[model samples]
Target: MLRTVNVTRYIQPLREGGSLPALAEADDDFKYVLKFRGNGHGPKVLIAELIGGEIARELGLRVPELVFAHLDEAFGRTEGDEEVQDLLKGSQGLNIALHFLSGAITFDPVVTQIDAETASKVVWLDSFISNIDRTVKNTNMLMFNKELWLIDHGSSLSFHHAWMHLEERAKSPFPFVKEHVLLAQASLLKETNEAFKKLLTPEKLQAIVALIPDSWLEWPDTDESPEALREAYSQFLITRLNHSDIFTNQAQDAREALI
Candidate 1:
């Protein structure tokens, strides 16, 4: 489970994407990039962000520390912007945040080259989660202190939006790997996939899925309990990891075509 923090101030709204995440100061005297629960996708996006990010970290990738940010009901009452005010009000509860990287710049593949191992790991992680982002146009990666850091995983695990035939979805070939920005550089897919499979055991996956907030799992008109939802996510990931070869082969073939 993630440590909780009280949001002290709203610094600014990050308008990079539709979700409208913000840069804010927390009670711990540190700034964080806060993902609100009031966003259009609601808590589902937060759930994806947490699961994808933690899994990446466990796979030895650079991911910022995550925390559960709390918003008071009156936090944004005086804001003159009606749009911002409504968003704040609706998100007056537990939200997700990442430690803000102060001087990070968007990753430019042209300027900086990633080695085969790192690129392969990133590609494998993205494929495992079925992440739709991380294309050449929008990498959703940052270069902080000359090291690559991943962020904005809200778009992964899209199966949650329509939770039917989840096991079938887990076995998807993930042909989208052809468009991944790092696919060409992921030359060690086979080796990396085998190594990563050992790192993410069923117990580790269950622990990660258990971090999802109970409130977030309470989907509208859904009959499933939070525990059941967590189990579903865990099972989906376990099944996907077990059948890693489907996507690994897809990625290897895609990489071969590029080369």
Candidate 2:
């Protein structure tokens, strides 16, 4: 079972881009970043964040633990303003209080301290899930305690829905480069594939799919069982794994070049 702690409402606003409301934690003991889900967008994005975080941990990635949080109705309001009640209305679901990775720096693809081998593996993982979040500009990766940590998986597997309508989606295949780090240092690709197969079982998939808030689904009137959703996701994983050889080959090539 995942452990959770009660988070206080007191937080400082982060002056950063994005419509999601963010705040810095008051207590220095653990750096807790609060992100409020946009009511208008429903809770699909938040659900993705939660599920992805858990899956990453299962795959041996250094992902910070996350928990659901209830936002006080007056969470973002200034000190004492009665009229602001409605402004903070309809806020709910999953407060991700992640452990702060101290002295960590974002990996830059252009001027990277990480070797080509490692970079290749990271890219392969991102591609496997079709994650567009960890691009050159926003590679939400951090290095702490001499280890790499992956954060912000909100953007992965998003295209699962659009695959039905989009024609060119299959053209851009997943990349499997030889200079990947996983191939050189560890068989991360093989391990991740195995883990994924184990976790994508019908039972596990149902549990994960059930975690998504009902409000996020497109057709609120339609009754979709968690089991059905899980099966769909399972198929998706199987499809990706079937092409695991591509990533492995890429990692091998990259590793050989470095040696």
Per-model TM against the reference: 0.98, 0.66
* Distance from true location, Cα of 31 in model 1, Å: 0.6
Task: Single out the weakest 10-residue window by summed lDDT for candidate 2.
Answer: 163-172
Model 2: lDDT to the true structure: 0.53
Q: Candidate 2 vs. truth: CA RMSD? A: 5.6
Off by over 4 Å in 2: 4-6, 15-17, 24-29, 39-41, 79-88, 109-112, 115-121, 160-172, 175-227, 243-259
- Reference-based lDDT, each prediction: 0.94, 0.53
* Residue-by-residue lDDT tens digits, candidate 2, 1-259: 4444444554454434253444445334455555445533345555556667766665556776665555555455663543222324545434444565657777555554665445544655665565667654566777777677887766667655453522233224544333232334443555544555565554554455556544445434446664555455556655555555555555455556756
lDDT of 1 by residue, 1-259 (tens): 6899999999999998899999999999999999999999999999999999999999999999999999999899888888888889989899999999999999999999999999999999999998989998999999999899999999999899999999999999898889999999999999999899999999999999999989899899589999999999999999999999999999999999998
